[model samples]
Target: GPYVIPSETPRGEKYLSRIKLSWSTMATTASCPPPSVLLPIRTTTAGARLTSSHGSRAGHAVTTTGGAAHARPPLPMGMARALLPQRAPLLRRLLMAGALAASCTCFLLVLQAQASVPPRYDGFAYGVGAAAWKDAVLVEAFLDPLCPDSRDAWHPLRLAVERYSPMVSLIVHPFPLPYHTYSYHACRALHIANKLNSSSTYPLLELFFKNQGKFSNRATSSISSTAVTGEISKMAAQAVGNSVSEFQSGFSDMRSDMAARVSFKYGCTRGVAGAPFFFVNGFLQPGGGSPIDFSTWTSILEPLVAHHGQTIEMLTSV
Candidate 1:
């Protein structure tokens, strides 16, 4: 398996298309350097500037800036070539014609690995999004209702879903940590609330995040449980525009329990370790699970979206 190096660059689509057209399947037997790497790429008319080793140790990644275009550029070669499976001579010829920046080469390697096999568990993900489409990028977010970081990640992720609605699908799976004592209960409650009124999902989630302290604080724990129940009842009434008691009765229903179990199982089966795990197009986000701002997401997604369009155009032309 080739370690995926995530790249953010405008020209990725052409490179990806070229790799798909020219290269044979990359072997899974190839030695991988690390589990993941993040590369930040900036391109100018002159050439590309790549910041490598985004999430790994200092020496693991390599960056190239400014001088490649002037100097005889290195051949667009993936890192650790000895690790790659044997390829046809034609593959080498295509790579030599237009050299990719170091990071770009690594991204192509990741793409190659993806093309070689089926996804690990495509059906387990859940959330709001279009039906799965080959061309649409699948973004799976693992989040905890009680985690501050998850709350922070919500805003930027929402922006991404809105902006790239046509090109991407966002699926969120709740992963409540045990340490957050009432998190499971909250997850159950919210799931039922959302099921009762599908439109209430995001708003109720926002409400939970905004008032997290009330639910988690030691002083408020017992008192807040009852209080929060009432609060959710009020919210459910408002969301469903029905009698509060009727909505409240459904808040902790059996269906919500089943939904919570499903989400927890999905995360656990995938070996999700903590609060905020993100996967873009089935490739786990390379950088550690930190909350990325809107601009950062835009940088990562725009290239994928553009690459998708270019692929469609290329197919139409043929």
Candidate 2:
């Protein structure tokens, strides 16, 4: 059977999206040049100039009439993603667009064949590693802290995790939704609270959900100012015992961003058509519930969990 990519994903739009989206699925990192690099990086240069390779290898030269850039601007945080080898060229191209300068030269990135996609497990991967699962199969929820459905469902998830802490790892990944200005902040707040190692992810999740109603109904809305969103995220995270600055830093951590992006990417690859998505092992369960209640999770999840480890291993190879 041909593989399926979810519709909400940018990857489904074209070959590049499809390829980058499949990097983790294929257990490979796409081959491409690093983003922040000098075009013709030369070691021996007196002034603003160009050097193609090391050892001052003979290459073209361009003299700068004015002052040179003190430093290269940082690459966009999410650009250095680990994707599958065959699919990475597209993302590399996307990042290259950001590097346009007045200097005129044909930039060619020599991609090396190194296939290593970070073992990026998603779902509430923030501040610190998530609480370990017990015996029951874990339902690691990669939530959008500002999402109302996530707020409602988190209660039940908290209960399940606590009751079956011995059986399952209820990992809370409050990932930022691209559209919601507060979503990322909310998630980061929870991550900040986690710095203490025993904060209640449940309360943190709930507070954000309750206030989320005031944010906006539209998908692509911003939370007005960084100050307001930061305050709300800080308060929500504090409910679970996280300090403000700690919460703030974790909320903005680049690694946190990368982890969330990885989660979102996996959601696309795993057929996660919408939020409140559930990835139980490799199979996807409906958000919050299926057509029914707890039985829905049970009926569909039990058998799959029973044979999951082996099946997961098999799926990875595909």
Candidate 3:
């Protein structure tokens, strides 16, 4: 009927968030007969004692609705105690205490983990690139759209994706930290371009990065969803060779924030502390130069293209 508080219980965050200490009380009735005495006869005592053949037994009937429906005899050895008031109070106190302690411990552990992981993006993630280098190779690049080093590593991948076309697919992902102020906006703008034209996404992205800092971080981050649509529409006019209407449509229908989240998540998963990070076929490339070396990238990709060619030839013949 009333609430019960448990003491000394292990703590958990979820458990503490929305907790209700309630007890459903039920009532019970019992009936019991008094014990019958038997008299014993002795030669000196000369008195004979008689005992009843049927001994008194206690009986009970309980109902959840306060036992209003029925009543029953109580057993001589049986006891009925209210669970809510009698037992639940003590147990609730214990439980609440333990829960608080456990929740605190887990919170501390999470803080420790965050400390070691190097905060990448507590707010919005920015400055990473990912794309498909064709079915032959999946390219994952981490970059700071604002960082010169990241831009350096990014240019070659963009070029290869353009030059190679279907021979390769480029997937660009980034991990932007707070230190790089405009990284997120830059990455988001590129993502908006990618959404507009899946085929020519790479080159358009190169152009955007090539023409960086047109908008301030505060300006881009605060941009409305409708405004993003308009911005992407302008991309097609900037030597983008894509339909302005189509790009705007994609932006209108897209979840740009979630796009940023996925980009950040992937980069962080690959142990990226900073940009520009590159993973060619799950392999990490060193960063420190503007525009990654095409030779270094081809050293890995060319072989993959060759293998892919053989595979296609064999399959077609079959």
Q: What is the C-alpha lDDT of each candidate?
A: 0.65, 0.51, 0.53
- Candidate 2, run of 10 with poorest lDDT: 42-51
**Model 2 lDDT tens row, 1-318:** 223333334443474344545643443353433311324322222322222454321122333335453444443334434222345577787667755631222333212322225574545431222443433465656567666566666665555445433444556555566666656555555545554443565566667677776665453254455666567656655575555666666656776555555555555555554456666544556543222245455565556455656565788999
- For each candidate in turn, the TM-score is 0.55, 0.47, 0.45
Please provide, for model 3 over 238-279, each residue's C-alpha lDDT reduced to its tens digit, 9 standing for 90 to 100. 645666675555544446556766677666666877766666
Output the number of the TM-score-best candidate.
1
Cα lDDT tens digits, model 1, 36-125, are: 222334444444344454343313323355445322223224644744577779878778665656668889876664422223332222
Say which prediction, candidate 1 or candidate 2, comes out ahead on TM-score: 1
Show pairs that collide, candidate 1: none
Better of 1 and 3 by lDDT: 1
TM-score of 2: 0.47
- Model 1 residue-pair collision total: 0
> Cα RMSD to native, each candidate?
28.5, 27.6, 19.0
Of 2 and 3, which scores higher on lDDT? 3
